[model samples]
Target: MALILLADVGSTWTKLTAVDSNGSIVGQASAPTTVGTDIMEGFNSALSEIRGQTGSKEYSIYACSSAAGGLGMIACGLVPELTGQAAKLAVLGAGAKVLQVYGYNLNEDDLKEIDDLRPDILLLAGGTDGGNKKILLENTQALADKVSPLPIVLAGNRNAIHQGSEILSRAGFSVEVTSNVMPELNRLDIEPAREAIRNLFMSHIVKAKGMETLSRRLAAPLIPTPAAVLAAGKLLAQEMGELLLVDIGGATTDVYSYGGIETPAGMVRKGIVPPWDMRTVEADIGMRYSLQSLVEQAGRENILAQAPHQEQWRQELDKILTYPNRLVSPGLEGLEIIIAQWAVRISVQRHAGSMERVYTPAGATDVLSGKDLRGMNTVIGVGGVMVNSPDPKGILTMDSKGLLPEKPRLMLDSKYIMAAAGLLAGSEPRVARRMLAESLAAL
Candidate 1:
């Protein structure tokens, strides 16, 4: 029987899954993601174990990675809220943590900050096609020869991309030029830039994260782990109809919502993208690295209300803060569940939009901002929190009550196979669909 392999090399663990042509589960394995030295050690270790279990050497391998702070980026554009926002959204969709955003121009201070941050990639975008070219050209000139070897995705004014590309290329830098992210006002085209980011991650980010060995061994381009999961979520949503995905992890919580949104008649959405079939990563609400921020947001009142032993729980969490990899704490199940719940609440609150009263000539009217996922029928949970918790669905149903209007029937990705299925999505659609259906069956 022909076999296929899929893996997600995450920040703490490398999860490996082996499936057959029909998407039948063969075996699975995991190892601590080796980061101190070479990452290939852990990647190969998991692969070897899965191979040993299946006893098969001939298989196609596809992988995604979120190791070592996956794909940090800084975005620059002509306008802070316009094209810059487009660039930010584009990179974020490509599984990147946009650390900083700049608009108009880049000076010595900006360059220094970029150097200091040393982002995985720089997404430079600006003006609509046939619009302002001064900022894109000036920014390119300032960045030329300064940020050498650091890859830049020039997705700016189409009229100026040629000149900007020439300037940056002459300065000994790798540049990927894509079409304007905002070809016209209120028209955000991010697919080209997103594709560029993915391609560049394969070409340059692997080396940046010390995954050269794994990169060389892989049969196809590696995807950012978050992007891989988002792809899987999209595919599953298409098959199963509208769905919401909340994946809680050590460093971040990502929420993916899929559906076709109905816009108000005659009103154009200019403030935010529809974000339909899109993913949002909440960097400040994880179980470990962002635990403090989570605590601050969730508040002492909420924690005490849920877990009365707040002091004890906080103490245990403090220890885990030092080492986020120790996500599973024995005898601290209650605390972990509560933390995951808080993460779900805060993350979903941010991921989904709300309506507010706005004053107009006609009087106060309701204006909706962001994607409304109230009508979602399926809610899939993944990551350590959902997979390990005894009551994984509780995190969404009980804690995510206010944010999610209607209770979404819960599904869990306990096998850590969703990302693997996402990897398969590119190669075998039928198999990917079947595997995800199998996962959702547990709901």
Candidate 2:
């Protein structure tokens, strides 16, 4: 029998899971992640504690993801609207947040704003199919001048790759050039850029953060928290065939959707990859850290719109934001229900919007047309609030309202450890699949 150890190093918590040869979970554990501390130290301590309990000398595999340090990025564009949106999409796709965006008309103030952000990586893009090259080149030059030693990804016009690289190199800045995100006005090509961003993340961002010290200590490279989630999503998509998984965390809600293809029986499975038919939406609608974003998106009107009896919900939400650690008050049961409902709505809508953009061909009319999204086969719900609701009926509430598919299976990250399981699954597909099967069975 073989054993595997998995860990998901999140911004707020580190979740650990131990699985046996048959893919049954043996033990689960969690620990608070020391935000500013060396990630390796925290990871090692958690690993030690898990191993101590299991008394396992050797494990078959180990994997991890991190959200603590903040996955930062700078987005560049030719036109503020088209390429700009494309650039934003690329950053979001990579599971990182955009700290800044620079476009053709962006002035010195914009550049300064970018500098102030101190992003982990910069994604530069611009121009329509074969439009302006000078604009992209000039923006690249300006970016290079203001920020040196920062890794830059040029995902602009395909015709300008060489010229873009030359300008950045001459300025002594490291640059990686990829395919045009907006090759044509109507079509967006972002895979090449997404790949380049991940590569640069390994080469530049990790090292710059003093994470290199920890990298040498660990057996594998550390992954950004969102990337790990994305990796798990890709694996699930391949295995489950067009599935939607939503993980609501303390700081953000991550939605990963797979709309095509099942993993072949013989091929080895690993983390999510580009070109895989999938979409992700990360909303600030978290239970704690980013509750404000959820409130803003859900709005008092919308939240209260559904629950007329929850007049104090807004006050509770405000109070929760101020003191995140407090437990949900008994009187606010309806408010919690409303918040969960609203979060599900916003998160699912965002997920579906991205899927529609990617899967829906222009001018095509099908019953699943933007109107019939409810027909999607599977929707997997994760996170503490959804999993540990005092009322089991809450899960049913999501199902009834179409927030979760009626046929969906709800799996709680009971240990808050799916990320780690996901990372481990990347290397051991059979074990991952087995664990997933068992998880669903238990659910």
Candidate 3:
């Protein structure tokens, strides 16, 4: 049968899925991602497993990758609330990890931190269309002086583009200019900057990585894993109604929400309104590699409260933290499930919007910031924990305290097809949507 092949190359694992011409899943397999060596080593290994199941046949292929730390970037802008946040959101929407966001002008400490982080790209955004240009130029000069030659996407004030471009270009840094992220107060124009960053990621960063050979074999440009997942979430949201997707992985937990930005009744909106389709990656909250930090953040007492054998579970957790990749007896799997619960809970808490009681001279009022995800229609859980859990619904359940969906249907990405389907979204929307609909089944 004619078939389409899709792959997701992540930091810990490379997941593969085979889909038939009729948008039906055929087979799936996973192997450790060997980005440090040849990424294809793991890819071919997993491909061998797929071939074993489906037989060797000519097939179309598409791939997305979050291997080798994904696209790391540092955002520089004038004000913390205005241009700075805009710049950060632009990169995040492009599926990049914001290493740090610096407001005002760069300083010696900021310059030192940039060098230490050594991000793949620098997003310099400041001022409005004709607002403050001093910091825009000052930050550019600072970047030009102390920073190494790296790709820079300048999406700052339109008036300062020429000067900023000259500053970086003269310093031997390649700079890509786009429209201002925040042209007017509370008005965000992030698409241009997002596109610029994605273009830079494809043209410069991905091409330089070990996956370059693999990208040459793909049907289209290899995208970041999160970007593909975000695209899949958007596509699914078209049919599923307002939704929230939480992907709990070993190193990070990413939360994506769609079409819930409307202001709730009896509440005043504050801060920059997030995009309808939004994503937040909590780096410190994860299943394996970040388990220690996750447990610490979730609090030992909280974990101990629900854990079966508190002291023994804590000891086992310590061992896992030291060697995150080490597999334990299946009996200890309960501990993982407990951690997954906290992972979902804590990650979503950070991702969701919040309400605060503010007193004004007029009277008391409720103010909402970020997307109001309360009453979201659907919540889908991705990643291995959700897929393998015996009780995914239990893990997905959020306490009444946070601003999560109220009584939303829960689903799981069982075949790990979200990112793979997203790789095919541009080429075959029907197949991508079908795969997602079938794979994301109710628990």
Candidate 4:
């Protein structure tokens, strides 16, 4: 008979659900997010209305995820190729929208590009462990000197920590330092930086968005939309044995997989693991927002590279980039199918790359061997882009060809905000598990 409130505050909408003990959604509501205004007031108003309808049962937990006020970030690296890629991976992993990336070789115009974007967080990472400290340090110094005092996460050479911290602090910038993302030429350790990034979001980014005004009124910390997704993914995986979740949003496409488990001591009762058994990847390929990034990655040449008509393919991509959020018209119907297919393919590939990197530790022989395409049991798809499409056939086309690995049984998210359910699952496993099952059934 327990009732739990789950909410996902997206950039455009705030979705809320009230789930009963048996995992049935007893109540649900949606509202436009009051960006740049007091979020708490809007949230409270929404919750009050839901509570009134559902009956005032004591809520066991209040869980949330947010993408409001833009979780924008800029990534800086020593080498444009290596660390830049790593920085992008980490940024995506943390669930923030990366506005731009800069490397040491980036010229004045590059710096200007980042400055113009006015990102909330700057992720600066470079150099392998005990590798070139000079390049990372110099880049950090240059960025500190040029950029306004934004929250900077230094996840580069471990040796450069004290010096980089001092330099950033001297420049009056708030800085958090973590382990080298590229600890070795062949290995990348992104957990520390990922954690620091999430903390920064809670401490600085949310505050900047004026979410703190609302968060202060709440009991728990205001978590970024992506972090909450990660949290929920972890719980789902642990509870259901193993799981894969795909979130295709308007701005980015994210894939999260959770496999294996080692239950913690105190957390045995409450299913919160100190570290997640989950791996996440975010591709800036949404129906809107970073639609251009999707096009760039898939490449006009690569996507059209195989097309029977090159000019037509190019023209369609242009149209998609121009009107990313527009519905597929009769004329461009085929083209929309092509674009969605390519976007899903590229997005899934990126997700696989992140999963392989995170799950397979350095020199681990039997890595991801048991669970490849053949072993995956379930794949859940979330977000409006996937669930709310007019043509189930078009959605199924992507699911069959683009979104999932070959072997898994695919399901759509009947409730769009599973992350919120996941967060509560940490505290109330039985209730959360039931709700998740109900959600799966509804889908």
Candidate maximizing TM-score: 3
lDDT of each: 0.80, 0.65, 0.86, 0.65
Worst 10 residues of 2 by lDDT: 364-373
In model 2, which residue pairs have backbone atoms overlapping below 3 Å?
78-126, 231-272, 238-263, 270-426
Better of 2 and 4 by TM-score: 2
* Count of clashing residue pairs in every prediction: 0, 4, 0, 1
Over 400-429, each residue of candidate 1 has an lDDT whose tens digit, in order, gives: 443364757877986768888898787788
Worst 10 residues of 1 by lDDT: 260-269
Task: Give per-residue CA lDDT, model 2, range 293-409, as digits (tens).
Answer: 888887767776765455566667678879988776776776776676667667777654211223345553222211123444566666667666654235423543422344655
Per-prediction TM-score, please?
A: 0.92, 0.81, 0.95, 0.75
RMSD of 3: 1.9
Candidate 4: stretches off by over 4 Å: 1-3, 20-24, 57-65, 105-107, 207-210, 239-243, 258-284, 288-342, 353-375, 390-404
RMSD of 1: 2.5
| Cα error, candidate 4, residue 257 (Å) | 3.7
User: Pairing residues by index, what is the TM-score of model 4?
Assistant: 0.75
Ranking by lDDT: 3, 1, 2, 4
Ranked by TM-score, the better of candidates 3 and 4 is 3
lDDT top scorer = 3
Candidate 1 residues lying further than 4 Å off, grouped into runs, are 208-210, 264-270, 308-311, 314-331, 398-405, 441-443
Alpha-carbon RMSD, each predicted model: 2.5, 6.4, 1.9, 7.9
